[model samples]
Structures are given as structure tokens and as C-alpha cells.
Target: MLDIFRGLKSLIKISHIHIDSAVFRLHYSLTVILLIAFSLIVTTRQYVGNPIDCIHSKDLPEDVLNTYCWIHSTYTITAAYRKREGLEVPFPGVDNSKSYSETERKEYKYYQWVCFMLFLQAILFYTPRWLWKGWEGGKIHALMMDLDIGLCSEVEKKQKKKMLLDYLWENLRFHNWWAYRYYLCEVLALLNVIGQMFLMNRFFDGAFLTFGIDVLRFLESDQEDRVDPMIYVFPRMTKCTFYKYGVSGEVERHDAVCILPLNVVNEKIYVFLWFWFLFLGVLSFFTVLYRILIIFSPRTRVYLLRMRFRLVRRDAVETIVRRSKVGDWFLLYMLGENLDTVIYRDVMHELANKLASRHHHGVKGELQEA
Candidate 1:
């Protein structure tokens, strides 16, 4: 048991001792820097804006205010706006005009939640790679090499083992990294799409219209009681219309009360879509760029090329040895002829001389023996 334990310890030590100084350290530093920067960016910006204000209240209708309230209660928005007129507003609901069912809303909400979960998952998935790279005895180089080769093989196994390693090494490296980052960005893009869709549908359906109607009603009701300052001007404006020869003329006065225009809702939806498209496009573009970089970069390209050459060389050598015993003399000759010209010439010359001497037999053999 002690001998077994001692052997295991020695193996572990040997396995760990072959670390790549340059690549490992560079990757470690980069991982640490990116993690710190990402964390700092998320953390320091957290409290800079009012959390309640982020979601546009104008995008929410009065009918489904309860749903909005529920969402807000769970996840805070950074900003909100209050309409000046006081009215009993029901919880904002889905616009009846659009006829969206409860099931659809639930599904949309669920999709949003899934997106959020994916974003969280992406962060979690990235954390381990960062942590592993940062750790002291992490064997990052071996991990990278394994990623490059697509499989782990014992170094000592030549022929068949080397062939397997070479095959894996060429095709796997870029694909693994691409799959990870692509999924992450894709999930984030989907989340943005869902959130934006919800906001646009909510705002345009009845939120702005309801707000507009409420304002118009308030103005009309106040005018009936002569409590409205604008009410007094109607008579004068009417008289001015009579005096202006069949045209209604009025004072060039504007209302001081700020009306939140419905156009703002349209603009909000436009901006949301624009940003959503832009972000997704950028993410996709970067993914493609990284893939190209992996393909074209000197180190990666050279590594892939070398792996391919090794595969070819191993296969050629194996084929020669396999057929040499079988009477495939023609195939063996072809292979030998195709080998590196200088090596082929030297090998052929040596073999030819040996065969000639063997046929000559006793004359050369007796001279050498004497």
C-alpha cells in the first residue's frame, strides 16, 4: 500500500512538472484581468441609477398594473415617471385591443426568465475556466493540449496512439470554444429580444392611449365648471373666427401643461429594437471574428497544420510496415519512392547494394571473411 501510494505521488509530481511557462502564465493573467474587469463593471454600475427607473412606466398599461407591479416587486426598475393628473389607475394589464391571452403573457414571462437564467449560467460556466487558470497547480497547458487534441493519450504510445492524438488535435480546438461563447451570446440576445418585445407590446397597445384619454377628459371636465383657465378663451376665439371672414383665428398660445405624447412610445420601441439588433449583430460579428482569428492566427494555424502532417506521416509509415510483410511489393515501392527524395534515394541505394552483394554471395563474403 505504501509503495502504491509512493508511486502515485511520483506520477502526480511528474504530470504536474511539465507546465508551459509562457502560455500558462499569459492565459492566467488574461483570465484574472477579464474576471476582475467584468466583476467591477457589473458591481460599480449597480447603484449608479435608480433601480426602479430602468423600466419605462409609460410602456405599461393601467389594466395590467398588477403584473407590472409583480415584476417590479421581484426585479426593480431603475426609473419611473408619474402623470400629473391624479386618477384611480388599475394595475396595468395586457391591452384588450391586442387580445393577448394570459397564457401568452405567461409564456413570454417564462422566456424572459429563461434568458436570465441562461445569462447566469454563462457566467457560472465561465467562472471555472477562470478559476482553474488562476490556480497554482491547475495544469492549464495540459487542458489546452487536450482541447487541441480532442483526447488524452499516453505520451509513450507511438504508432496507433500518436495517430489518434493527431486526428483529435486538428479538428476539435476551435469548435469547443466557439460552442461555449456562441451559446452564451445567443442566450443573452434572446433575453434582450423578449424583454424588448414585452415592453413594445405593453406600451403601444393601450398605455399611451389610456394616458391620452385621461388627459383629454380632465381638460374637458375642468372646462365645464369654468374652473379651466382655457375655458374663458373660447368665446373670444369664436368671435375672432367670425371676424376673420369664414376662418377660425386664435391666439398663438401654447398650453403650459406638459403632455407626454404617444409618439414617445413609438420612439421607445424603435430605440429598443435598434439597440437589440445592434447588440445581437455585434455579438455575432465578434463570434465570427474570433472563429476567423482561430483559423488564421499563426500559432493556431501552425499547430493545426503540424497535427495534419503528423497524421499523414503516421498513416504512411503504418501502411508501409503493414504491407511490407504481405507481398505488396509494388505498393511498398511506391511509398518508398514518394518518401522525402533524399531519404528515399539513400534507402534505395543501400537496399540495392545489399541485394546485389547477396546475389554475388561467396566471392564478396570470402574476401570480407579473409
Candidate 2:
């Protein structure tokens, strides 16, 4: 028991020693500052305007005022719906059917503010790592190019081809499996999107009325019509419009004739884009799946057996050649093994000698020899 306790103590001490002081301090400071800044921003944004004041104002409805209050509170925290109009609007509710208390609004606003700050911080933190990975990938690509050039000797061609075949075989195992699954998923998503289109149409029809005559006409009509409908209709519509001549009794409706067609076209375009993107994504996914399956499948086992048989046949031929000329075979084997190491040097020397020979022999003799 004492030994176990001692071991735990040692492990803890080792872990503590491994922790970098600079990194730990920097992380702690950044976390503290982020927290402090977020809190301050949230607090300021939340209670900037009083919900009670907006509610009491005759210019807006109780529901509208309450909605503004609620939205202000909610967005102060979440901030997902943050927009220029949202900031200016006294009420935050979409259609003003709901009202928010001052306390609720404040809390919501704070929540949104915190959410926004966290989202921004997350992006900032991840961007550096993403950039570093891109740089490393570029360097790796350059290294691969150098390696390919160095390895491109005639003697090393057979070995290089064998290595490439091995790599392809391994990758194919994963690809095959991935392709099958990806095809299945793509078919399902296509069916789902088709089903959703019908449902989306119904949803738009239901919601369209609210935005059309109700909201637009209210904006296009006179001041009396613009006044809170609940206040005017429930209490005194006759008194409100009594003095105005030819007020048409019918509210001046702003024809959103363009809206329905525009919305339909937009929806069609969005669905088209969605299908296109989903198809591309599935194509890529399937390609990878097919490669994976080829690498791991039983079918690949048979393919590898064939490869082994071919390799053995080639080895037998090489063995016969080696037996016929043992010394030459040993030299050839050594040269093949270190082909990349000597290829550039040999090429340069050979080219220089040829050029010198050509200079001495003259262009006519050099051409005849070639």
C-alpha cells in the first residue's frame, strides 16, 4: 500500500514537471481575459434599454414590446439571430404574438453575447493550427518531388513499380468498402430531399400569409392603420378612422406579388445547389470507400495471391541469371540497391564525357555514332 502511494506521488510529480510553465500561464491568462471581456460585453448589451420602458410606450403593442424585451435577453446570450434590425427593434418576437418580461430579455441577451464571444474565440484558436497544417503539407509535397526525381534511375524502376503496386493494393482495400456505403447513403439522402421538398412547400404556404397582406399592407397604409391593431380594433377602430374621408375602410394592401414567385425560384435554386453539393460529397465519399474495400476485402486476398505468384516467377528468372554470372550478378544487385544514391553523379559524368568526345570527333562523327 505504501509503494502504491509512493508510485502515485511520483507519477503526479512527473506530470507536473512535464507541464510547461509558459504555456500554462498563457492559457490561464487568455481564459481569464476572455471570461472578463465576455461578461462585460453581455452585461452592457443586455440592459442597454429597459423592457418596461418599451412596454409602456404607446407606439408599440404589448406583445411587440414584450417580444423585443424577450429577444434582447435571449440574443444577449445566443446571438445566433444577431442582425442590424434586431438591434434597432424594441421587441424581438418575429410576429409580435409573444411578449417578454424585462428579466427574461436581459438573461437571453446575456446568453447570446456569451455564445457569440465563444464562437469567435473558437475560430481564432483553430485558424493557427489549420494554417500550420497547410504549411507542413506544402513542405511534404516538395520532399516527395525531390524523392521521386532522385529515385528515377533505370536500375531502380522495377523496385519503384513494386512499391507503387503495394501502396495501391493497401489503399484499394479501404476504397471498395467506402464506395458501397457511400452509394447507399447518397440514395437515402436523395429520397429524403425529395420528400422534404413537398413538406417545405406546405410550410411556405402556411407561413406566406403572415408576411404577405398582414405585414406589408400595414406598412403601406396610413398612420391610423399602422397603429397597433389590438389597441385600435379591440377598442376604437370607428373613432380612429372616423374623420378620414375615402379611407377605403379596406387597408391598403401592398401586393407582394413578386415575393411568392421569387421565393419559389429561390427555393428551387437552393434545392438544386443542395442536390449538386450532396452528389459531389457522396461521389468523393464513395471513391474513398471503394479504395478501403479493395484494401481489406477477401477479393483482394486472391489478387495478392496472384501478385505473389508473379513475384516468385520473376525471382526464379533473376536467380537463374545470377547463377550464370555470380560476380556480375552481385555487382548488379549492389548497383540496383543504391541506384538512387549514384544516379545523378553518374548521369552528370557520363554527359560530360559524351560532350568532350563529341567536341573532339566533330558534329558529323558524333551524329554518325549516335
Q: Which RMSD values do the candidates have, in order?
A: 21.6, 21.9
RMSD of 1: 21.6
Error of 2 at 76 (Å): 32
Residue-level lDDT tens digits of model 2 in 110-228: 22233354334434333333433343343223212233346466556545444433432333223333233333433443343343334333433332222223434656778533533
Off by over 4 Å in 1: 1-46, 52-94, 97-100, 104-119, 127-370
Best by lDDT: 2
Give model 1's TM-score versus the native structure.
0.21
- Give candidate 2's TM-score: 0.22
lDDT of each: 0.32, 0.33
Residue-level lDDT of model 1, residues 1-370, one tens digit each, is 3443344333222232222222222222332333334333333333333211212234333324433432422210111011121332111111221233324331112211322332343354344334433442432233232323324344432333344334323332323343334334434444544453444336334232233334346566754232221111111011000011122455332111111122232233333334433454455456445445543454443343234334334333332322222212222232232333333333334433444454478577888999
